[model samples]
Target: MTSVSIPRRMKGVQIKNFGDAEVLQYKTDLPVGVPGHGEVLVKNEFIGINYVDVYWRRGMMGIPPNGIIGREAEGTVVSTGAGDVNSLKVGDRVVWLAMGGYAEYTIVPASLAYPVPADIKPGVAAAALLQGLFAMSLSHKIVQVKEGNWALVHAAAGGVGLWLCQLLKALGAKTIGTASTAEKMKLAVENGADYVINYEEEKDLVKTIEEVTGGYGVDVVYDGIGKDQTQNNVNVVAKHGTIVTYGAASGFPAPISHATLTAKNIRFVGPAESALMRNIGGGFEKWCAKLFDTIANDKINVVIHDTYSLSEIVRAHKDLEARKTTGKVLAKP
Candidate 1:
């Protein structure tokens, strides 16, 4: 591969102030710095738009003033810093979950970069890297789901939820997924969900869960929709089962009753990427490599709902926030 001089300036979508999607604006002359020690500069080709980005845009999760937005992207290494970061080199195609992947060029620590599999498309890598690893970490490390156990995945049609359903099935667990629409329900079923509930129509989510489990409650509930689904998740868990609350997409906070938890013997687990990384010692990149292998071997299927150009990022965010998108959304640079 031929090495090219890193550009002095790059384009990025900057959010100067917290507001709606319209607040995001294109900045074409942003400084493009060289990779420092133990860092690599990536020339991004595709970036993922997740629900978390929406939170940042809406100021639900405060960002440092003048912070660059976005978390996951796929690109090629344009330059590398000094030290023992030998795995990556200029021209290498890679994917990483970094702080500011919305830009055309961004610097990431060597630890965060992982090689993209030959079989995976750049857009697929961007779409799946962060969410796939999150799902894998939750299922294998956090919940430790075993064979034949039943798991309930909330927001099963969303990016991470869809991946969770597939990963749970691969681990030999029966998955019951919940989506908001019929189209999403169908997608979940096609993606390995044994049972799917359209929460919009099925007001009694707990009853539907019981019916799917043959009167026995699920062994684990991956609640990403938060508030609306959290309590019901706790209620539907079998004795000694675990309830993992990973996301809050329902615009409300999940309420927990201490008395109810004590009576049910249910274990409540919160899987945060930062916390998991701290506990595991090696951080998320190690888990990301394992998931990339799964994707390469066809052990898991990543669902990408749509792709848009970088200029259309606001529209992309609008669709995602509106729940109009079923799976992952990608923005290509």
Candidate 2:
């Protein structure tokens, strides 16, 4: 395996106990991890900040004890571990979907790492990789969206939300997006939402979406804002339509009776993107390729809401949780 001059210590954020953003402890003396079998030691250049990270930090999601608090990052491989690494070698610029990303260095399994093309900037790759693949899985795998299909996307200005807008647009779907503010609504529209609703102002959101679709209701709803919007999703879905609830920004959606779905023949699924990716053969590589290709061809745009230094992670989480961000947020170590 190839190796380089590695450091004994690096900077990272560790969560000893789950609670809130303050639980994330930034330290300069954290040990740099070594790559194990089929793993690569990566020097992270840019780390992606996702809402899911907040869940992990707050104990809403299960993580290993004393775990680091990030899921994805883009970096350069400084060392390779034992065994075949899927043709990856030291010095390869790659993006990975894995745990422990809120660090200057990470041990990434080669299977989760994809080489970044020369034209794609590290920050762009970092910003788009996870969310782009997630959006694809939601629109294509979770439910096969067809041309002219109507999709309702909640938090349409968010990381995954914006990507959903672009992907659904590329598929010729009519998208109705809900955002909290005028600026967010504009961003959603620019990303390809056919209709945007300021949910904060629109007292009757269900009625507004129904009107946009001419009383037919949306064919599918991508709901990231759970709990508060859960019942509303059931109310606005068309007959036989699907609702993919992937995140719980507003808290996990309340459980529903099976009969509620049966009443409209609606399908409710809430698969995490990691599970969805693993279920399909070569899913990681396939979606990563699709994401990079689309970006290369100008088929999609990567919006960066902000970039924070690793030390500023707490403020970053606060911004995200407060709905102060419109697109992907990145952190540089």
Candidate 3:
């Protein structure tokens, strides 16, 4: 276990009010705290910007009234606190999904740190951690996709959706993905989508899905777009098929009518981050380690579209909210 001197102060991005990207402020020379018990101090190289970060920035998800926002980053461990965390030490190159990752330095629980492979860049690792882990966990553990089964992923060319396509393919399930543009549709197909639906072009999403599945419909639909796709899910899911609603990117809650499910004998599962965090007793850290292993072995590939400096975070947020960028967007401090 090598030791390194930790920085006393660092630069960071802070959100003082919930509103637009204008609220994000750059603070230089903020005090950097040492790792407490069972913690490791990370010198961040790159941080992943997610749509949820935008939601947090806008007060949509009920974050603290004024909070530091970010969920994933990759960096090197500079120090460790007093504890008995196994297989982790200073100088380890690691990626994690702990909150407060937008800073130049962050204190992460040793349990949450997982080493990045030599072949994987810090930017790529940062982009992969949260979305890849979520997709892998949902497809493998939550939905339990089986061989020859059909799975539908909404926003399939976006961060988590692209990863879900790969994971479902690896699990032997046939994948169908929905995107808004032709470029995104092509990207989804390149990423292992057996069928790609351009929802903007195809108003009849259910009909296209049914035709692709030979009128039997799919076994599962990973509905990340929420409200916009919820009603159509019933028309596309086979009898006894499961519909997992994980995100609400459509900016509204999905409307559900009891008769729809009752008539089709369908089951709906909600895979919220809180529920997933509860299901994995060892917590997100352990789950991230498993995700890292999969990436190292080429079982999953993380897609990153662009990287911006901390000063350019506002522009990054705008691009993300406008849906102009595909795959993961990242920030380097």
Best by TM-score: 2
Question: Candidate 2 on 1-333: residue-level lDDT in tens?
Answer: 555788999999999999878998999998987789999988999999999999888888787434897889999999888998888998899999988899999998899999999999769999998898889888888899999999999999999999999999999999999999999999999999999998888999998887888899989999998998998899999999998898899988989789999999999999797686677546688878878999999999899999999999999999999999989999998
Per-residue lDDT, model 2, residue 329, is 98
Q: Is candidate 1 or candidate 3 better by lDDT?
A: 1
2 or 3, which is superior by lDDT?
2
Q: Which is superior by TM-score, 1 or 3?
A: 1
Model 2 scores a TM of 0.98
Q: Candidate 2, 269: how far from true, in Å?
A: 0.6
lDDT (10s digit) by residue, model 1, range 9-81: 8888888888888988878888898788999999999998888887787787778334678887999999899
Q: What's the CA RMSD for each of the models?
A: 1.9, 1.2, 2.1
Model 2 poorest 10 in a row by lDDT: 274-283
Q: Which portions of model 1 miss their true places by more than 4 Å?
A: 64-66, 278-285
lDDT (Cα, tens digit) per residue for candidate 3, span 1-333: 676776687888888889998898888877787889988888999998998888888888777422678887899888888876446778889887677877898887776778887877558889887788778778877778999999999999999899999988888899999998999999999889999989988978898888888899999999877788888887889998899988777866466678878888988888766457547646776776677788888877678899999878889998887878888999999
lDDT of residue 314 for candidate 2: 97
TM-score for every candidate vs. truth? 0.94, 0.98, 0.92
